[model samples]
Target chain A: MAMAAFRREGRRFAPLLHPNSITAPRSSLIPQELDPEGVRFISTQVVRNRMKSVKNIQKITKAMKMVAASKLRGVQTKAENSRGLWQPFTALLGDTPSIDVKKNVLVTISSDKGLCGGINSTSVKMSKAIHKLNSGPDKETKYVIVGEKAKAQLVRDSKKDIELNITDLQKIPLNYTQAIFLTLELVLVDKSSQAGLISVLADDILKNVEYDALRVVFNKFHSVVSFMPTMSTVLSPEVVEKEAEAGGRLEGLDSYEIEGGETKSEVLQNLTEFQFSSVLFNAVLENACSEMGARMSAMDSSSRNAGEMLDRLTLTYNRTRQASITTELIEIISGASALEG
Target chain B: MASNAAAVPFWRAAGMTYITYSNICANLVRNCLKEPYRSEAINREKVHFSVAKWVDGKPQKPRDEELWHGNHA
Candidate 1:
C-alpha cells in the first residue's frame, strides 16, 4: 500500500522531475570528460549554429527565385514578339528542300552561366544527335558552339568537329544589332572560299559564298514550367529557290516586274542575308527565355528543401530544451527534500 | 511600284523603304532567276550607321568573303 502511494506521487511529479542524465553531478567536484550535461550543452550549441546557416541559405535561394521571375517576364515578351515575325518568314521557306552540300554547320545555342537546370545539357544532346546523323565519309558536319556550357560538354565528344566555340554572348541582354554583327562574323569565317571563287566575269560569285545548310539547336520555352530542346534547319538559297520554282509560284512572280535597273541575282542575295539574320535572332531569343525559366524552377526547389530541414531542426531543438528544463527542476526538488529530512 | 523605284534615287523613291525593298528582294529570290542577277539584286541593300546609302553607284565596301580571305593574303 505504501509503495503504490509513492509510485502515484512520482507520476504526478514527473513534469517537474529533471531526468538524472541531464542534471549536472553535484557529488563530483570535477566534471568528467563523459559528463552528460556537457554533452547536451555541446549538442545544443552545434544544432543552433547549423540552424542559423540553413536560414541564411533559405534567404539566398528565395531571392534568386524572385530575380529569375522578374527577368523571365521581359524575355518572354521578346520571344513572343520575335515569333510574330518568324512565322511568315518560315512559311516562305516551308516548301524548300533540304540542301545537299559537302559540309554542313550546326550552331548550338545555350547560356554561358549555369545554376539553371538542364538547359545546357539538352542543347548539347540535340547537337550530338544532329552531328551523329550528319557525319559521314562523303559529307562533313562542323560545330559552332555559342556558349561555354555546351562547349564544355561537346569538346569531350567532338573535339575535332568543333570549328568555332563562341562565348561572352550572354554578358548582356541580346539585341538585333548584336545578331546582325554576329551573322556578319559567321559569314566571314565560314564563307572563306568566296574570294577564290570570285571572278570579274563570273555571274555565280554570290552563289559560291553560300553555305549548304545550317542547323541551329536550342531550348524552346513552352510554358512557365517547361522547356523543350529543338532543332531548326535552314536551307541554302539554292534549295529555297528550287522549292519555290517547283511549288509553281511563277504565276505570282509573273504579275510583279523587277525594277528596270535591279538584276534578279542581286535581289536574291539580300533576301538570303535577311533570312539568316532573322533565324539566328529567333534562336537566341527563345534560348534566353528557357534559361530564365529553368533558373526559377531550380531555385524554387532549393528553397523548399531548406524549409523542410529547418522544420525538422526546430522540432528537435524544442524537444531537447524542454527535457533540459525538466532535468534541472528535478535536481532542485531532490535537494530540498534531502535538506528537510 | 517597280517603275517608281526605278525612276528616282533610292532615298527619294516613294514606298521604296528598306522594308519594302526587302519584300521585293525576297520575291525575286523566290523566282530562282539565273546567276549574277539573283546575286546582285540582294547585294543592293546597303545600310551603314542606320543610314541607307546608295551602294549601286558608290564605291562598295569589301564584300564579307573578300574581307575574310584578304586577311590571310
Candidate 2:
C-alpha cells in the first residue's frame, strides 16, 4: 500500500528529470554531449537553455520561409511570362531527342546555392541520363555547366567531360566589358541587361566551342510544391540544314521561308543562336522560381517541426518543476510527523 | 517563293558574330515583355558567383586581380 501511494504521486516513478532524446534536427540545436547526471542535477535549467536555442531556430526558419515566399511570387510571375519566348523555338526546331546525335554539348543549368530540396540533384540526374543515353560509339559528348552546384556534382565522375563552367556571369557582362554591352543595347533592347549578359557569355563560349547539337537541362516549375527537371534539345544550323535535305527529324524548318536577303543558312544560324539565348533566359528564370518554391516549403516544414519541439520541451519543463516541488513537500511532511511521534 | 527582300540585320553588317546578334535578339524580346516581369526578369538574371571554368578536369582560378580594387579587365 505504501509503494502504491508513492507511485500514485509519481514522486519516485517520475522520470521527468531524465532528458529524453529528441529528433535529429531539434537535437542538433542543443549540445550533443549533455551529461545525464548533470542534467538531473540542474533539471529545469537545461530545458530552459534548450528552449532558448529552439526558439532562435524557429525564428530563423520562420524568417527564411517568409523571404522565400516573397521571392517566389516575383520569380513565378517571370517564369510564366517567359514561356512564350521558348515555345516558338521548340515548335520550329523540334525538340531533338537523346537517342541520336553526332557531337553533343549539354548545358546543365543549376542554382549556385543549395538547401532548396532535390532540385539540383534532379537537374544533375537528368544531365547524366542524357549523357548516358547519347554516349556510344560514333557519338561524342561534352558538358557546359552553368552554376556551381551542378559543377560540383558533375565534376565527381565526369570531370574530364566538362568543357566550360560559367559562373558569376552577371558581373562579367555589365561592368567587365562595356564595349559588348553597348553593342547589344544599340542593336537589341537597350535596357535589357540580361541580353547583354547572355551575348557576352555567348562570346566567351564561342571562343572555345565546337558541337553538332546543344541540349539544355533545367528545372521547370509547375506549382508552389511541384517541380520537374526538363531537357530541351537544339541542333546546330549546319546540322539542321543537312538534316533538312535528308528529310530527317529537322524537316520542320523547311516550311518557313527566310524573308530577309540573308540566305536560309545564315538566317538559320542566327535563329539557332537567338533560340539558345531565349531558352537559356527561360531556363534560368524557371530554375530560380523552383528554387524559391522549394526553399519556401522546406523552411515551412522546418518551422513547423520547431514549433512541435518547443511545445514538447515546455511540457517536460513544467512536469519536472512540479515533481521537484511535490518531493520537497513530501520531505517536510515526513519530518513534521516524525517530530510529533 | 520570296515576296519582299528585307535588308540584312545591322549587327551582321557591323561584323558582329552570330552570338552577339542573338544576344541582341534576346534582349529585344526581353524589352518587349510587359512591366514588372521585365524588371523581374532582368533582376533574376543578375547572379554574382565567384567561379571559374573547368578545363581538362581542373578548375581555372578565379580572377583575383579583377575582384580586388574594383578593377575590371
Candidate 3:
C-alpha cells in the first residue's frame, strides 16, 4: 500500500520525476544543477517577473484601445455628417474652368504614436509614391504634412521636395476654417498673385499649376481594423463645370439662380471657391477618422494577444510548482526510508 | 521602501493606506500559517494582493506585497 501510494505520488508529480531521471551523459552535460528548492525559487521568480511585465503591457494597450475608440467615434460622426453637405457643394462648382495654374502640393497624414502597427508606415509609403509620381527636378511638389510621424518620414526621405510641414493638428481644433486657411495658404496665394507679372511668369505658374484639381491621397476607413489607401480628385473649375452640367441635367435644371446684388459670374466664382474649401475639409476629416479606427482595432488585438500569453504562462507556472512539490515529497520519503533501514 | 513611500504622490499615498490596511490583515493570516505550505499560500496571496487592493478602490501603488509573495511562494 505504501509502494502504491508512492507510485500514485510519482504519477501525480510525473513532470518533476521524469526530468531528473533522464540520464545525462555526465554531470557536466547538465547545463545547471539546481536543487528542488533552487528550481522552485528560480521558476517562481521567472513566472512572477514575466506575469508582472505582461500585466503592465496589457494595461498600456487597454488604455490606448479605449482612447482610440473614443476618438474614432467622434471623428467618424463628424466625417459622416459632413459628407452630404460637401457633395452638393462639389457638384455646384463643377462648371467653372480649372485655374490653368501649375503648382504641386502634397498633403500627408499619419498617426502620432506607434504600436497600433503599420498605419504610419503605410501612410508614409503612399506619400512617397505620390511624391515620385508628381515631383522631379523639372517639376517641384510642395508638401503640407499632418502628424509628427508623417512629417518626420517625409523630411527624411524627400527633404528637398517638402515645402511645408504641419504637425499636432489633434491638439488644435480641426474645422472648415482651418481647411480653408490651409487651402488658401498652400494653393491659392501664389495662383491669385499678379495678373500683370511677366505674362510668361503668370502663364508658367498657371499653365502647369492645375490649381483647380486638388488630388488628395489617404487611408479610407472601411472598419475598425481595415483601412485602404484611397485617392479622390477635387475638381478644378473645368471638371467641376462638367460635373455640374451632368448633375444639372439629372436634376432637370436649366439655369442656376443667384439671389441678391451680384452678377451670375461673381456668384459663380464665390460659390466655386467655397466648394473647393468644402472638399478639402471633408477629405481631411474622413482620413482622420479612418486613422483612429485602424488604431483602435490594432490595440484591441494586442490586448487580446497579451491575455492569451498570460494564460499560457500561468498554466506553465502551475505545472512547474506542482512538479517541485512532488519531487520534494519523494526526496523526504526516500531519506526517511533509508534512515530506517 | 522608504524612498518609494516618499516618492508616492498624495493620491497614491491615500491609496497605499487602504492597501497597507488590507495587507496587514492578510499578513496576520500568513504569518500564523506553517512552513512550505505557508510560503506557497503567502506566494499565491501576494500574486493577487495588488488586484485585491485595486478591487478595494486603491490605485497607483505597485502591488509590492503580492509581487513579493509570488516570488517567494
Best candidate, TM-score-wise?
Answer: 2
Model 1: docking quality category: incorrect
Q: Candidate 2 lDDT, tens digit per residue, B1-73? A: 1212356566655555565654446556666778988765554333344435566799776431122211111
- Native contacts recovered, each model: 0.00, 0.43, 0.00
Task: Report per-candidate DockQ.
Answer: 0.03, 0.27, 0.01
**Residue A56 of model 3: what lDDT?**
91
- RMSD (Å) per prediction: 14.1, 8.1, 23.9
Ten consecutive residues with minimal summed lDDT in candidate 1 chain A? A200-209
Instruction: Give residue A193's lDDT in candidate 2 (0 to 100).
Output: 31
Cα shift from native, residue B31, model 1 (Å): 35
- Judged by whole-model lDDT over C-alpha atoms, candidate 2 comes out at 0.66
Q: State model 1's lDDT.
A: 0.61
Top lDDT hit: 2
**What TM value does the first chain of each candidate achieve?**
0.75, 0.78, 0.70
Question: Of the pair 1 and 2, which is ahead by lDDT?
Answer: 2
Q: Model 3, stretches more than 4 Å misplaced? A: A1-41, A89-102, A136-138, A188-212, A235-269, B1-73
User: Could you tell me the C-alpha RMSD of candidate 3 in Å?
Assistant: 23.9
